[model samples]
Target: MSTLPRSLLKNLDLFRSVSEHDLDTVLQIAQTMRLQAGEPVFQQGQVAENFYILLHGHLKVVQTTPEGEQITVRYVMPGEVFGIARAMRRPTYPAACIAVEESIVLSWPSSEWDHVIARNPQFAFNALQTVGQRLQDAHTRIKELSTEEVEQRVARCILRLVDASGEQTEEGVSINFPITRQEIAEMTGTTLHTVSRLLSSWKEQGLVNTGRKRVTVRRLDDLIRLAEGQPPGGTAASKRNSVEPL
Candidate 1:
């Protein structure tokens, strides 16, 4: 827990502006927890009694449809605070947070939220900013779902994840966490079969590579063009991208 103190928080926008004295108080109340890959951090509709900060690793914020389909809203990266229902004045979490990889989390009782905010006005402003950004992202996704084609939505989702947690590789940019096409379907409001067909076509087009639980963007420019409206189908992984018949 040595790393859980205020010094590390200086890198975080939410806490960087907090006074040393006020940050120390937050440190005093902070509790740390670890979760294994594929573990549930919190279930949907659970009492949002605490605020959580991701110190290490990634998670997915998801909601389940009435038919039991999982809809992935977004990925939670390290240094981000989650389970924000407390700040939003919600009694329960609207979605589940699941660890996509092994994770370390810092938590604080929601009862102490107001105390921390009063001590550090910047904290409140930061929280508002975080919530506002989240809402804005939600709005963007809603607009995409309603207006964009499925191919466009999936392409945008993959590109965003790439920007969020991608690592450079000889092959291209690989997502740092394990992800399946089914999850992509959930994120894009499509079916597994549809996602598979598109990915298979993308693979042929030399835009992406897929493995057991991985996806790598082999040609981002091509993918961006495809996402924008170009069809997919090609023979070689060429810098010159085109949509040929599979």
Candidate 2:
């Protein structure tokens, strides 16, 4: 296990607010690990022995449905802490985390968590906030699944990806990594064909551009308007109720 750099340690949510002296203590108990794309950081139901703070790259949290279909729960980005089964008191992971790109992460043994939390109560508070945000995102996704049309769901998903990991380019805002139509289907509870068709329509309308593994939003405002079921230039108040807090 490589030692974590002070810069990376300071950026982690779990360690960000700690005093430098306290951070040094915490760093002494942590180890850094690297994962390649498609690597499994941990498997669902495996003993939960460690938690992680990602320093670079992306991870996808996924659950296997009863029917054995893989459902994407969320994407974990750099500076995010994951594998919190220890905090939740689970003996094993509820979902599997797989690296979507070459990634670097800080790992702390589960046994050290209690000590760190005791020494830094703020760690626990930050963890709770992270979990709460994820829950809110899940709720928003559930609402989209239950009430929104396929087009609306895709629009929302694209917007969300942009928010999470979009990069600004001359073309527009592009989702920073590759994602498949099948994955989009799983995330939105729709069919791949539906997603592809909607994306195709958006492409024609100058709303988006798609390639084999990426999608770029050429006109985000148009997609937002479509999400609200309103015409372009609609008032924020008119769409306020329709917009779900993420």
Best by lDDT: 1
Off by over 4 Å in 1: 1-5, 231-246
For candidate 2, the lDDT comes to 0.82
Please write out the lDDT profile of model 2 over residues 73-128, one tens digit for every residue.
88888888789898888889999999888988888898887888887777888878
Please give, for residues 1-246, the per-residue lDDT of candidate 1 as tens digits: 335756777778778887787787788888888999889889999999898889888898999888996788888888887887977889999999999889999888888888878887777787777789898988988999998998998898898898888887777888888898888998888999999999899898678889988999888776777677786444454545432221
- The candidate 1 region of ten consecutive residues with least summed lDDT is 237-246
Instruction: Output the lDDT of residue 215, model 1.
Output: 92
lDDT value, residue 171 of candidate 1: 78
- After superposition, candidate 2 runs with Cα above 4 Å error: 231-246
All candidates: TM-score: 0.89, 0.89
Q: Tell me each candidate's RMSD, in Å, in order.
A: 4.0, 4.9
Taking the candidates one at a time, how many backbone clashes does each contain? 0, 0
RMSD of 2: 4.9
> lDDT for each of the candidates?
0.83, 0.82
lDDT of 2 at 123: 85
Locate the minimum summed-lDDT window of 10 residues in model 2: 237-246
